[model samples]
Target: MNPPLFDLTYCPIVPALEVIGGKWKPLVVYHIYLGAQRFGSLLRCIPTISKTMLTQQLRELERDGLLHREVFAEVPSRVEYTLTQTGLSLLPVLKAIGAWGRQLKEQQAVPELVA
Candidate 1:
């Protein structure tokens, strides 16, 4: 018998990681958690990201059905990005991760390390 073309039975988390697995994906999603924001705002919030890198991450997230981008044909070409329903579903996950990180920090040998 032939083996399955793709082996996803190992774990379900594999698929979630495929979408928001990138280093910046989760951060980008977290930024959008507040509300719709402009491209400039996203860049400002994530100062470490370059224009090119941010654009690439945004496109990837959009392609993954986690974000929605709207472009306006104004003088400056306004663009806004907002999280989709699928993306909103990650709120609880993000919150949980944040709590876990805090716990790890508090329990670490050097609690101040988290600061």
Candidate 2:
């Protein structure tokens, strides 16, 4: 019997990108890290994103095992999203990425105009 062959020969980043490569996924994760658990709160936290796009992003994150969505049985049918253990493990990496972004912005800052 032959074993199944897995293809990961290109680069190591590919797998990571496959999990969190989209423009919105990182932002969604960041917002969730900041305690935006509910759908409405997430929408408000990232106002620039459309409702449809947010929905898509949330679904993808949930499907990828980074997010856990819980629904309550009640009249209003409340729902919430939280980071799973795997998702929480990515927090340090996310923070480092944020720090790099800030450092890059600072390094590229334009000089103030003079009179």
Using all chains and alpha carbons, the TM-scores for the candidates as numbered come to: 0.83, 0.83
Q: Which portions of model 1 show Cα errors greater than 4 Å?
A: 1-9, 109-115
User: For residues 9-109, what per-residue lDDT tens digits would candidate 2 score against the true structure?
Assistant: 55677788888887888989988877738988988888899999999999988998999999999889999898998888888888888899998898779
Q: Give the winner by lDDT.
A: 1
TM-score of structure candidate 1: 0.83
Q: Record all residue pairs in model 2 with backbone atoms less than 3 Å apart, i.e. clashing.
A: none
lDDT of 2 at 6: 71
Show the lowest summed lDDT stretch of 10 residues, model 1: 106-115
In model 1, residue pairs whose N, Cα or C atoms come closer than 3 Å (at least 3 residues apart or on different chains), thus clashing, are none
- Kindly list the per-residue Cα lDDT of model 1 for residues 1-115, writing each as its tens digit: 6546587766678888888887798899999888888989999999999999998999999999999999999998899999999999988998998899898988785645534
RMSD per prediction, one decimal? 5.2, 6.1
